[model samples]
Target chain A: MILEYKFEYLSNNNTLVNFLTNIADASDMKFEITKEKNEINFYVDADEEAMSSFASTIASDLPMSVFLQNTAVSLVQEMPPSNIQADKTKQFNLPFCPKCLQKAESAESSDYYNPFTTCPMCCDTKDIKEFIVSFGDEIKRTDAYKEVFEDLASRIHQGLGVRFKTLSGTFIFEKLENLQEDKNQKDIKLLCTNLANISNVVVAKKAEIVALACIEKPQMDFRINELYKSKNIIQAKRLSVRYPNDLILYLLSKELRALGIDFLSYKNEGSYDINVDFENFDAKESLKIPKLKILEQNRALVLESENYDKKFMQVFESLKEKNKAHFMVLLYENSLLQKRILNFYTSSRDDDNVSYYAKDLEGFLDVLNYRLPKSIQEVFEDIQKEESGERLLKNYKNKYPDSIKTALEFDLSVLKNASIVSFWKIAESILGFKNSILDNASLSLLEKGPRIDYKLFESARIYNKEFNYIKLIQSGMSFRLAGVDERTISLGYIESYAHFISNIADEVNKEMELEGISLSGDIFADERISHYVHKSIGKNFKIFYNKDFVIQTRF
Target chain B: MNILILGIGNILFQDEGIGAHFVHYMDEKYEYISQKNSVTIVDGGTLAQRLIPLIVRYDYLIVVDCIEAYDSEPGDVYFFDFENAPDEINWQGSAHEVEMLQTLNMIRMNGDLPPSRVLGVIPKRIDDDTAFELSEEIIAAADTMEQTVIKHLESLDVSLRERNPQITISAMAQISFKREIVNDSGI
Candidate 1:
């Protein structure tokens, strides 16, 4: 078997190069494989069933619940209306990587100025010229759009923030007309130079890449293997130890069940779901039977936060008046707590309505503008300088002797793994900005700051530190959103992770022009929403921030 | 007809550092080559991550590596498309999740990826058990890279108005990982 992408199955933007680039930059899916155009290929032990499932995912065109970065984008089948698509010349040569052209999500990301040109996206002189020429042709060809695009292109060429995207994975310029007071834009270079300042970078992609490479590949034994003695090999090596996928499913399912919620394990999709009745699944189809059962409802859906409880009661109560019992708000109250779980749910005053429950930090993160750290943040200087050894750990016995034993038990190897280091460092950084610090970087952590991070909770905005067993067992939709390798998470390297979700706001911004969407008012009323799904996992349609409650239910 | 320079080798195994060494060699010895922006020097390495950032955007990709050409003598010079390259010619190994071959496979799978050619120089020894110095044969191979580069430039009809006569034409093969003895104080 071989691992490869069938081109017809992938969106134009989801090219192999782009996918690999994203994985290299942002994810940790091991067992990399490749294929020529026509055949299904596998390397590093890809199974026939898994391969077929992947192929079907591409062919079926099912909506996926992909949690990328930290944002939750409800991808639907809608592309923003196009205004000036035939005029392609103006849009020809805009740079590809936002990390370089635009500011990184935070100042800690990395320095980009004078970077080596061999960087795949760093076009050579000719490529740049080719880009500009493409831009020019699009402009010259478009009799009407030319005037609009040219100004934007010029701004971009002169180094400014006029870059935007189209539904077809192309960039459109948004020219900032009338450069307030300075028509000549004298400080263009000076202003542009800030984007490249190394000193300004607090976290960098390059460092992360280097860190990823440091972990030694897991050891494997291959004695007297005819495969190794082969003349030539096209397949990648299989891991000696395969993590138990079934065991994980069982664990997660059992955990959720223990929480008075039964969950369904979709073996092929690599995701788990709650025991919601199947007859009420989605707008397209209703489930006739729920895979699992929930206890009786209308028992006072005890919510952790009063504000969340209030929001759900209001939205559903308003809809409840209309007799819209399609589904109740999706949360259930649980009395027994192994861990403090915050939940908010809206049910029909009667017992027949459906309810949604989002049971982790992600579900509860957006209440009252709960702030999160930028994708990458600088750790405190002290933590980086800590002497995390048995010797140093023992010296702290007087203050807290318990620390010595725990420190000794800590796995230095796991800690040394660069990716893990960066992960914990990121977590530490996020913890620092929990409305805690007053630095410029910390200020960016404000809910309305440039970056946004979402949490994926079990029911609502509660964190499950002790119920780690169940969360670990049921690798759900929000698993990838945590920006960790499935293997690592499975091995229990991390109980929580955050995906660097690309904000759907940009997609919204582009839809207006590309798809010709003209919503005058009532932002949600006329918006032609699009659905985006991950290629493999068919998880629930999870929206990170809505009424600030973490509730998962049939929509 | 872009001029491509590929530096290839396993940086971890001491002597396999030749590929990176050649790249640093060019970066140091031939400063003018890059200013032209006509030649792209890539550190192909054991894994292809370094080369990835520019893979999709280039027209030509030239890789320099220490080829364990089993059939050939030590320090032999050869170029072969990896897909059709001879077997018993171990261009890849199992020390990595992402190998040079897999990376190349990815590039091949990615339509519109750049055309590539690997220049594999014969290795005297890609390990440290041998002499602790650059082998004379490897040094000679490293010197030959200059000629190959010039041949490319000549083929492209790119005349270097200020060519450095002192640099020889050879691609060297050495092993070096990231942790080198080089100090930041520039001592």
Candidate 2:
């Protein structure tokens, strides 16, 4: 008797289907496999022993993909006519499977210690070679791939920065302890080998861990634990952490693990002690199904688009040209929320026209002007002239001796020329807090804190046309002056800003009848900001973010 | 009538900045009649909604920017009324285009939008690295754009007088490029 089993696999991508087909071909059982829509049907000459063995093998080793929504297996009555054909499924560029990893470590195998080694069950080696060739000349093949990685690991262990090309791009890696104190560490990322390694460094939730281990391994910012914080390896309270995505990094991570080093700090572009020059391969861009996309970064909560906009498709079909339209909003930490506009005819996707509008703080002040007392103006000018917060506070303390009292009584026009940075600088001084990096100051408030609502910043008009950033900053300052904790003040500011931005977006969408909103920029990566923004927006309009690139693309 | 000529584009990209370059070109070469009708030229840059207060105050608006049209060749110039935009014309290619259109639509919804027309050209080189030079095709097309704008202004009872010698777009590009290089070097 012949028996059939059908398995329903969700996802449009061919990764799971390819994996199943490859695994079936490797099995000794005489089985026919066919797919109809999302279901994969298998027919076997019912040898119970062979069928049970094959089923157990599949159950033990199924490839993990975020796109695989659900799977179900059930016995079927009938099988379609056998139509065996050549396997033409596109090979996914994914991490090595358990079998491939075993082969890579075995000395008897041809793929032993080969960084470029891949099988039908894994990624396409030919595509990898082609991408590497695109970087430069032909690759110099060698049997000493493992030796090279070991040497690189040794150098990194010796506290030297080494540059090497990953599947994504070139990066420089160094021990966190070796990083210079004065060096800018804003863009630095902590790369670990696995979940256990990452957990040792930072405090991460289960969702965050799952996100890091996912196929599209994104760099996530997490608060450093007490142990790492006391070590003072990095200055920031929160560190961007990520797991190794490429083979070379994976191998290097193993070698580093042997040396008792679990993680390293890295940045995309920098001067390094050693350059590991080799043919660089590129990873095929993965299909990103955002779990929790806040602005541009994808986190743990899966946010999937339900369906294509029918109205947009209708407009697209009516149009005669193959031109692209971009609706982008860029939100940087210290800079103004910049809205870039460009609609142009292009021969190809590469022909992207770029432009920028340059406006100084004076330009912003001209649009949102406010009046202040003469005394406050003098104090603001003096504080602005001081180079550091310490100096600013010292000068003001010597001059007035009761500057905080004055700050509490009346609104100051100091914010006229203030960006986010200057706002933090002035606020820190008045609140008796030491100067901290903007990211650290913000992250410090991630902990649960008291909720305090201060008076809204006094604006000239209630519904101002432009974003009243100055007033928002002033509101935070008021809370701080009113003896609220720093954490509470930070939470308050984030909430206020989120509400303000969401309201503006809602108003614009209502007025323009736009299909959706597009949010970009790195500042949106902050946990509180992302949470509040999404909560405030609340399904009123579809939110679009970058799928190909992270919110903050390095280099 | 209060007439406003707003030039928008990013100068960093090669031909993407043709609209901005054209405004500078117009400013240098001609002086328009402003007695009867107040005419203002603004290098709007990549700004969209931020210019709402300034844009709506005018009685008539002329926008100069890069545009994409179906079945159009590089350097193809297009002129159309904003209210009655052609089906073949698309302003969804880049961020600023969508934003500028959205800004106009928002204003229209509030009944504050003025009678507006867009004078745009198909750019030849926008993907190239930072450069101020316009492509030869776009440079030639600018003449057609200039003449059209002049004719429209004339219809509004405004005339242009040649106040200075004709300054080539290339010369304007050279000046802008030099200024950028200096600023970058922090000299």
Candidate 3:
């Protein structure tokens, strides 16, 4: 008796169909796949014993994809004729499958020790490898790639940095413990081989783990576990982690696993002991979250859209052409919006595009039409000339006595030109730290830290048709003056900023029916800020993000 | 006068790529636009500020791109001078459009902005899905836009000579979008 099994999956891509087809091809099983509007169905015919074996293999070795939402297998009475056509799904950047990995390791196999060994189940790396090999002697080409792989593994084992190409771009990798003395380690990400080891270092849910290992291979920030925190594996409370998403990293992981190394730290830029060069394969960064992408480098949660607008094209076109009051929320470089009005084009002036960060205190004060005392004006000018934050504070206190107290009493006008520089400078001065340390203060307090009450800071005040960011910054400064811990103050500032962004979005959405709200810039990569904005305004309107590009500013 | 015929758009988006494809359509079909004027055509693919230096070098600029307009249907084309752009035409529709406007403004501030005219079409589709192929509406509109740009260039004292066995816009799109050279003339 023939038994039929059906599998259902979600995702617009053909990754599942490709994987199933590969599995069927290897097992000599006949299967048929059909894609409906929402879900894809796979029908397979086999005997009871064969069916059980196939299901077990699939369960043990199914490739993780951010797109694979659900899979269910049920017995069917009738078997349909094979309608399997040539697999035309876009090739995904996936790690080697068990079968491909075995082929790479076996000396008898033609692909033995080949760094670029990959099957159709993963990516089209074989074609890439072939294209590179076509340039030179095939044997020498294989030997060179082998040498590079061996050198990479040796360097990784020696606790030295190795530079290698990923599908997206070239990266530098070193063991996390070895990079303690490395001063330029800010953008580094801890790489793990599997979810089991990843869970040992960071606190991650099952879904988050799946997202990290999925095809997209986005760097996800997670709270470092107690053991890692105590060990100080990374100085920060939260660590960004990723699993291997390409062939080179996949092979590297195998070597790392054998060496008993759980994690390796990698950054986009760094000098390394060894450099592995291969034919450039320009790979696009895949989607982290299917619909709503937050923090391009971090965790992505694939959520299904129930009310997805089919006429999004029509809406986008209409917004682009005729909508005068529509605001483009560009917070990436710095929070600024381009309000397309009649004056924007007719007048070729720079001030038409207002910057979120106040260029200078005097200019900002001038814009608000607030007349500063002659002494206070000179004091600000002196502070601006002071290069260091320490000196700036010292000179301010000496020149304008009780300035912090005075600042507390001042009613700020707009959040648009709020001094993000001033907020950071004040935090740095009080904490006796530099800009780098203070820059990460908010993110360090993301997962676990003391929370300050909202009442402590002045609520978001609307004045002169803008949100008051200066008042919020002043409140944080006052708290710092009151001897609040840096962690608590940082948490407070982050929460306040999140609410500020949400409030701005809400206010804008209320004014007119917008085509859609766009969120750009690397600043949105902050989980706290992105999450708050999404949760607050995501329900009301469609928030568009960079589809082809990562949210992080590349510069 | 030195003339620069620039087409700007992201080819990854279906109809959003009409401008980039149109320039290639022009380049492939026309060998020399005029002997009197040195005319160069460039496919400025999603580049905004980066094209400013190249644009300023030319005395006259003709930009082929997509624009959003009030009460406009897909395939509708609008031709207007940069100084006197219609209020109905919104250049703030896409990121590239916004950047292009800023680039022009920056040039104007630097006192280097050329006399520029835009030949824009109402695109039918600009979605997350990547495609090199144009929508049926945009494919039909390409001819009208091509005529408009050519007419504007000719009025600028720039003549045109069509290449023998001229390549169609659809064929050019296939070559550009797929990165494949089609041997079959029928494509």
Candidate 4:
């Protein structure tokens, strides 16, 4: 039996596309949806069976926080004991004002719903619950979701034209324990499909979901010829259906076609595939990678590095397609070299509402951290100001007096020398550098026999860990003079390192607050401000204003 | 809970002795375990059977061994928890009876078994008869085994008794592609 029910609703503002997608995914069985404008119309077909089960499933996985009386009850109010002889022998309680027992009033229905706050003048349970506006910080963390869900449930019972199927006229019901166990999406979908298959009732996630129907699942399920496909499917030139696997048949077919694979047809209702020719395709064959590779297109080249012109260019030949955006390139921001490009690119495209998110660790930090690196530098500055730093520097100079002395101290001159760069590269590494950003970097640490020649601080992890990373950022070469080849040299290695000089220069974005300096609200919010300030100070000091992301605008 | 790790290796031959060498460090000075932390450490001494009880009792059983998977780096770490299996198409049988890929295949796809991992550190050679005569270069990577374990455990929302780890975030791939990558990359 087929039954039709419809209702009008004003689309609420807060519903996002994701919410809609979730609803569609959950209600994938029985009801078919056709969207025109913002309105969704559902067409359902099933015997007057399984309606209650369907309703319970929808009620359970509503993405809501609470349950209301209406969600479980019917719009048709239970008749108040019509045939019963009135309870004339009712016991009496303390006398109360006649007005206190007044039925629900509707002067302003939505706003007057608090049971406890019933006006001393009149009592009402008919009104919808008023919005609880004073939900504090705790609610932001949770709570408010519960209230909304409850409200929607209650609204359902308040006579909203709800339809109930007749199956010997017995209403099916469910318990909460069973619903609570349906936690994950998979389980929820199963429950909804299961419930709708047995119980003949309908349910809605929102008060707005008007048209709901439940159908039965035939044991043999041979109603296939009766079903028709939506026209939208036939009109589709492109459709994006995201699955857990990237090995999509449609995408594979397109790729196969591009490689000149021949004549294809639907193999079976289950599955089919065509073998692709990987030989010619690997050689960057006739197929050209598009500028902005369309989603689900044959192939897309993702930009992983921001230095699109140089370092990326060096490795471009390695990529199958030399020139193309493919789908999109995910760029890392930490590379001082790439930051240079982004610095220019951001300013140039600022007018186009261009937002660049660096895919690299350093780039991600520089953009997201707001002020971490700078704070690290500030901490360094604080440490430097301590009387102990002078003693440490003086002691090293006295001990070495020459090469060893210069290298022992954090000196730019000594750090720049190849010998020190090589030596400290090993020293700093041995001390601790393996797990940093430098882990992915390409650099060598040189050791000079048993005397501890230097450390090469090759990995990006160097800056994140080493206590003296800020000191090295000031005059990277001088770090070698400190007798430790402990300094970041790779343009992509340090988040704060910039390229202002002939080579990639160090730049620290030190974020901090000195004893007397004024600060912004963020400084008080967390220690993050100080850390970022230190790195900012370190990067800012090192920047010669050459790289775009680092010193994108100025020197 | 304190995590006790037993790394058995011989980096001398390339990748064979790495497990033993790694255990040497993990049981000795690896910051994750020995870093003045509440964690305990043990050295399996390239002796798998001897450490069976210890491996089974520990919250996690991490085996750092040289799995002959063709061309892999001296210290490249292959992480596989028996609970999460690789795809069947790629999971050709491995030499060991308790093949990590195979075990994981059973657990993840078929939903059988529990949690444990058999890390296959691809080495240059397995020595004459899986002897622990690691080269100086391969021996140098003993520290990485500890790092790999730390990274993997952290992904499960766990922290060692001491020592914070460095985390690297990667982009999310589609599930099927993810499965392929996990299999290939772990292999």
Candidate number with greatest TM-score? 2
Better of 3 and 4 by DockQ: 4
TM-score of chain A of 4: 0.19
| Fnat of each candidate | 0.00, 0.00, 0.00, 0.00
Best by lDDT: 2
lDDT string, candidate 1, B68-142, tens digits: 656777667776665577675775432322356666777788674566766677666542221124556767776
lDDT of 1 by residue, A1-555 (tens): 534332221111122333333323332222333332222122222356754554453333211111111111221232332121122122211122333322212335342221111223322212211112234224222222223334433444343432221111212221112122233332211111111221121221232212111111011111112343252221222111101011111222223333332211111111111111111112221101111110011001111112234545555555542112112232211111122221211121211111122333232321111112222211222222332222222222333344333433434333322222223333322222122111122112111111112222334321221111112212211122223223322222121111111111212223221111110101111001111111001131222112212222223
Superposed Cα deviation of residue A367, candidate 3 (Å): 20
Model 4 C-alpha lDDT per residue in residues A174-279, reported as the tens digit of each score:
2111222222222111112221122211111221111111010101101111111132211211111111011112222223334332112121122111111111
Q: lDDT, candidate 3, residue A474?
A: 34
Tell me the tens digit of each residue's lDDT in model 3 across A278-388: 564555532222222334333333222221223332333443311111112111211222321110100011111111212222211111111212233343444445323
- The 10-residue segment with the lowest total lDDT in model 2 chain A: A341-350
Among all windows of 10 consecutive residues in model 3 chain A, the one with the lowest summed lDDT is A341-350
Q: Is candidate 3 or candidate 4 better by TM-score?
A: 3
Off by over 4 Å in 4: A1-555, B2-4, B9-14, B31-38, B70-74, B85-114, B126-133, B136-144, B153-187
Give candidate 3's whole-model lDDT: 0.56
Residue A222 lDDT, candidate 2, scale 0-100: 77
TM-score of each: 0.28, 0.46, 0.46, 0.18
Docking class of 2: incorrect
